[model samples]
Target: MNGIFGYAATAPSPSREEAARVRDVMAARGPDGHGLWSSSDGRCVLAHRRLAILDLSDRALQPMRCRDGRYTIVFNGEIYNYPELRRAAVAAGHVFETTSDTEILLYLFARHGAEMLSHLRGMFAFAIWDDHARSLFLARDPFGIKPLFLADRHGTLRFASQVRALRAGQGIRDERDPAGVIGFMLLGSVPEPFTWYQDISALPAGHCMSVDASGVRQWRYTDLTAILSAAGGRRGDRHAALADARAAIRDSVKAHLLSDVPVGLFLSSGIDSAAVLGIAMEQAKHPIHAITLGFDDFAGTTNDEVPVARRIAEYYGAPHNVRRIDRAEFLEDLRAILTTMDQPSIDGINTWFVAKAARENGLKVALSGIGGDEMLGGYPSFVDVPRWVRRYGRLARLPGLGAGLARLMRTVVPWYIAAHPKAPGLLRHTSTIGGSYLVRRSLRLPDDLADVQDPAVVKAGLARLEIVARMNATLNPMPDTPQAAVSLLELSFYMRNQLLRDADWAGMQHSVEIRTPMIDIDLFTRLAPLIGGLPAGIGKQLLADAPNKVLPDWHRHRPKTGFSIPYAGWMAGIRDLDQRNGKAASSNGLLSRTWSNYVFQQYPAGA
Candidate 1:
């Protein structure tokens, strides 16, 4: 993994020093080396900061040009299947100077053009400067596991692996995007295609863009929901489905282990991390290193993941390291955490510390169990969303009646139920899978966003965001079952927008590359046939049993307590510290809300 930045312009391009300054903004992401390349005509420039994972040789250094120099590329991700792709390139009469995946990527694009995206199998956000065509081709991974932000001003296009990196460059405007501001307020993270700044936007996952004299054009190449929806025709017996799922998990775990450096696992009490650890042990030639994050507050309580994670490591005979963090450490690191954050998010605190632990332990690459909940039926939304759609869906179809009933329930019900924020949206959201999911995952309901944001901004932002409509679009060619629908929603929205984005910024903040085997496109495609066919909850069990060893009964049956930090208690401590220092303390309600407000305050949209 690395930090990549460049510009393509109709006018004289940005200077090498300017490009280098933007690349250096993400210095933490790449500590190995740096390079800069500019077109002879001075219309395009590419710069890269290398972490040097796959090939540790200088030959693999990039802004790497093809043999004939028709293509020059700056890439910021790993391509897991590069070995196989390289063999094919060689067989087709291409020569390779380095064994790096970036070389293979350049060759594949030379041979296949945009079609090369479908052949890739890892996280990436890359820009290829086609010297022959005199255009720039930019593409992001299907899952958006890596980030690419773009800024277009007067036909000069600047792109980077980070939003802040783009902002650090000259000529990019800093005007706040109203939709982005409200999206962050409503979702705790800014949604895709919008950033905190109006002048920059994310390159949507599963899509590619080409910039040339005719201007820019973008088009989607893959859609996960559509893949799942079309998979209904391939259903098989439950036993066969389980077998397929096991094979897919093992294959994915094996593929994600593609690294030259010592790879580690982020083990937790949850089945997802534990399962990945088990499979890694079975497949690894060397004992895998397992890292777990433990909190001082939860050390002895059931919430602590240390003891259980340690036991799992022992069971696998892997090296184990538990890094214990306290409220004091959290407070001390607060400023740095917010500063390193690529954009405002409420979810990266845990990822931030764990990634730090991995880097401190001398690990450059680590595997995580991030997408397990969405891929398997692990989240409560899998059960609750479908149930809500069935029960209140009909009632929600009636416009005024549903809203009236919601108000009536609030007036007459018990205080706890009346005060519950989601209850008010029940009637409005239950009509469809997307609407129900918005209720399940939103940090604040649309009506409640007005409390924190200007009413006019709230109104205009909602109109521009069209959150519900976009969520619904992900369900196009809708899946056969509610379970599949919710899974698609969770994967496309929560995991894609928040979890994956957080992992990118947080992991890169510490110069560590965190890979997710559970989020593999190949694995998802292989198991697509079983997604709507298998009984609920069986997918996770299949994953747990993928390895040869049997997991302890306690782990399999343990309640799904998600990986969490004591943020509420930590924030309260901050408030107390502020009061003692004669400063105004931030008001508290929901911890998520408070943190969201705090992050926004630190990186105010207007600024």
Candidate 2:
């Protein structure tokens, strides 16, 4: 909801002007106010740009200090359970200064230290400056819903809400990270713990770090895969599971409506967004405003979401706003969109325009249904990954046999099978849940990238990224079922690295906060027990029935086309434009793969 930047160093702190420059780089994220706080000893500084969603008073402004003067904090996010946490703090003999979650966080940290993270139920990326301890503590939410990028140089650590902001600070080196560039080529987005710049890295989700005279230390406090694995055997009755899921959805939707300003919903034809709209109408004290993005190219076609979403809004009796865009608008906004992008991504173009429409309509916060698929087995990966593991897992265990067979097929098989890019990977990766999921989700395989990128860069990047190893680690002890394993892979990698990260930068670019009820930790906790136990497709139906009335049969049974735009056709136009102008453009391979290459070429590392 805001932009935060600061630094803690063994040496003197960066100049106040320099820190403010970093904060100002994210001015669009927080247009309401700005502040800077520096320690008297010049060891640390905290700066903030305020969007003023929860409490619109100067009293709520941060870098806020605790009453005891021991702790000062700068935070960027909402703590939905702060009202409950505040009551506990008051009972524990703490006095309050303002009705803001940031104050409650400072008091809780004073009382519980790092243990306070477990008590929180919201999205956040924050840094607390302990003046007395002369140490800095930084933590990101369990889902990485908010971003925190860090750069350490000469024992000085700098943190910001954005990678571009950190680069604008002019303190970190501008050297390109080879792993990061290749990561974008392979995955269409730079994976966490790495960034486009060698000097900057994203803080991994569910993790925290501390910097002091003892040097910096980082650790994980929560792991979603571990939680899901631990709850594997507790498969209760199907009816009871459905009831629990409904209650969790309602509770999460109500909590996400915590903003003081009017809240809105991003309505779509999909079950995920429609379900959210229905629940919000039932729970919100006021009428919920709903917004949907429609493309002129698909206005009369099945791909357009406007008509279906409008009918859903009418059924809920909520105010609806539809924004229709055309190819001309896409061409005009392409430059600004790329510049606003914090990293190279084949995704986020849809999010960018939708968030822009929300802001234009005077909405400061909106709820999205992004995480529903990953949590409820709505993706094809759920079926394909498990089947691959079951059928070809034994072949993978034989190691060289699988590899040798794959090589033989590529060289000697029929042209269609031999020329297929993923055919060899399917044979080689079908052994483990991680490998199978990779085959399902990778934008371009390592072998595919080898045909485009330098072999040395591809080799080094794969080694540093350790893509499959990292994916498998999320399933640490391994889930009890293939379904649960695929869920962990999708949530831990695709959602964490791409969906959630894209939502953050895109929403912030337009100064709108996009909240995801489907992504809540509490909701996931309540439904984790029944992940692999329930019948296929039943989980989504449970969500559809969460509100007072079940969704229409036509709405629930519609084939999943996903919320998307006409990107392929539009990119073809862009390619044509570039070719006519004598500029190089990628014209071969899958649209997503070529789009990934084009995005990197425009926003290459260190640019």
Candidate 3:
């Protein structure tokens, strides 16, 4: 993982010294060394902060010059398939020096042009300067797992890994983007293509843009939004979908485990985590290394899941390493976590810490079960939406007290299902604007957000949610079913915003990389449609369907417990101390809360 910064002028004239300043400010990202490259007349400048992962040799350090010397590249991320691409290129008569993916990426474009994107199957964000065409091609991975930012102003085009680096560039400052801020506070992370500052924007995932003397143009090469934003399919076909899910996911797991360095697993005793462990154990010739992630607050409660993790390890006979985390450890790491956040988010703190542990365990790569819910109806919302649709149907046809009470209940109750835990689980399905938004990401409802709404935010959230609903209506054609469409919208809008961003920054902060097998194109494309097709069941039942022997009985039946930290408890503990000492504690220590109150002003408790 590395930080990349560069600027292209709308008109020529940013100096080398000014470029040097941008490099200096992002030094923490690449403490090992830095490099600056520019065209002969200085129409552009590319700066790289290196965090040596692959070669550990100067040859691997980037802002790399091309084989024919016509192109230069500044890149971050690993191309897991580089060795194979290198072999094919070498067989086709190319030469190489350092065994680095960065160099391979340049030549891959040199040989394949735009088609190279289709060939790439790893996380990445890279800037390729084609001297021959006098153009710069900037591309992010299909998943948007790596981040790239662009700020265009006064005829200048600027880009970087973090917004701070962009802010440090000469002749640049931006007004805050209101919608992006509110999106962060309510959703816990800002959705892509928008940043906290209005003038700056993210290069959407699965997209590539090129800029030169003529100007800039962008094209999307792949899409997750289209798949997840659909309605139900035929229910009876699930048996085949389950079969497809099994083969496709197992193949991705095999591909993801293909790393040059030691690979480990993050096991949390959840069905998703245990499922990955089962496949990993089957593939391992020797004991596989696993990290059981947990916190000290659960030390006294039965919430400590380390024992279950140990049982999985015992079953697999793998080497299990238990690493306990505490509030002090969390507080100590809070500042860096803030810095690691490219945008404020409530989640990812736990992801960052786990990656740190994975790195400390002498591993460079790890596998996580990230997409099980989207594929198999794993979330409670997916299971209940079908039931609520039935209840709502009955009420619409009735002409009595029950009908009036049902309408009254829905209006006063945040949702119809709060009457029982199962109801919250059911009606809170991701089918409509409010319910979909809440199901996927919101820590607070629109009603919950009502307490902290500034006039601007109310408008923006409503507009965004309206756009999402309309998009779902247009995209999802399945009749009599809204679950699949809701799942897709949630995955596209919220997952990309919160989950993937957290994985990228948090992992990079610890100089480690995380790979997800379930989201692999070949896998998800086959399984996602079958989710809402089945009568109410677990969101990711396809994952658990692998075999009864593979998972714990409790895990198979457990409620969907997010990979979460007890943030409310953590916050209250600090609050008590502040009251006693007559000082205040920052909710900023928690990304979600920080974004909610400071950025969006929408925490349920209010500032």
lDDT per residue, candidate 1, 1-607, as tens digits? 1222233343555677778898898888889988888876677888888888998999988789999899999998889888888888888888889989999888889879999999999999998988867788999998899999988877778889888888777787767888899889888888998998889999999899998877889999988888898887778677787888898989999999998889998888999999999999988877789999999888788899988898889988889999989999998888888888888898998999999999999999999999998888889898899888888889987878877887677678846542476787788767888888888888788877877888988998999999988888888888998888888888888898899999999998899999999988899998888875656677778878988896778788787787999865687655423332222222223557667777887873333
Task: Order candidates by lDDT, high to low.
Answer: 1, 2, 3
lDDT of 3 by residue, 477-567 (tens): 4334466654565456656677777886687667666777766665656665565565555445556655335665666676555676755
Q: Flag the better candidate by lDDT, 2 or 3.
A: 2
Model 3 per-residue lDDT at 217: 88
Clashing pairs in 1: none
Evaluate residue 224 in candidate 3 and report its C-alpha lDDT on the 0 to 100 scale.
61
TM-score per candidate: 0.95, 0.95, 0.81
Q: What is the Å distance of residue 356 in model 2 from its true position?
A: 0.7
